[model samples]
Target: MKAPPHFIRNNEEWIIWLLEAEFSGSATPHALSSRTGISLDTIHDNFLYMERVGLLSIERDPDKRYPEEIARVNLTENSLRVYDELKIRPDPGDLF
Candidate 1:
């Protein structure tokens, strides 16, 4: 599905869309960064912002490395609602 024209167009939209469409609502920040070509730090920053806004829930694992400490990231109901509304899906040909 394509994002509606009125949908908030930003990196975070792509992040949440990826989570909903491909990852079953949960994935590592590192994997997301790899998939989206967004930096790990940027993904972490977005996660924090999304969490604060009640869009995402982040789980940290100290057993992992620095950024990987953010072991898992999941979309919240609010985010899922947005995804359902926007229906944004990146073209598979556009991804690595």
Candidate 2:
């Protein structure tokens, strides 16, 4: 399968890591970078991009956990809906 777009890969990685972290009860950028080997800067930059595209939600609330969180990435519902519109599956794969 063709690799996901470089940007998309980064964004997806971020979302995956963010949810993983949240579920694992750890939501720190440092932890994410350490887990995914995606640099902190890249993660943060792509996060803002994802946020703009509405694929990620970055909210700030005084009562919210991690109130000063730098990011809160996830696959927005719209993103999943868009995926259906552009769906393509790999034929089959084994490294040539």
Candidate 3:
């Protein structure tokens, strides 16, 4: 599936989710969606793309990616740093 127009609009949310997860010891898709407002569908789809592209690691639990076994959004060192500097959540009604 094609990503949402704004799915990659700002790298902040993506970076934050990954950084937060890495720092917090792993996170679920829900965490990323809640922070980014990218929608669960979008998150999963992009995650799959990330896996396909090998930017990060991806493991499935019966064809599903769960926090217990994997981080939905993986953060590289750069992403982690970007997230550390990023503040403020995206405004409501701006998720599209």
Q: What overall lDDT goes with each candidate model?
A: 0.81, 0.51, 0.51
| Residue 52 of model 2, lDDT score | 87
lDDT digits (tens) for residues 69-92 of candidate 1: 888999999999988876755544
Q: Between 1 and 3, whose TM-score is larger?
A: 1
TM-score-best of 2 and 3? 2
For candidate 2, lDDT tens digit of each residue in 1-96?
A: 123323333455445434433444225555555666766677777667766877666544455343235644445666555444334422234223
- Stretches of candidate 2 off by over 4 Å are 1-28, 60-71, 81-88, 91-96
- Per-prediction TM-score: 0.77, 0.49, 0.46
How many backbone clashes are present in model 2? 0
* Candidate 2: pairs in clash: none
Model 2's alpha-carbon lDDT is: 0.51
- Best model per lDDT: 1
Worst 10 residues of 2 by lDDT: 86-95
Question: How badly does each model clash, as a count of residue pairs?
Answer: 0, 0, 0
RMSD per prediction, one decimal?
Answer: 6.7, 6.8, 7.9
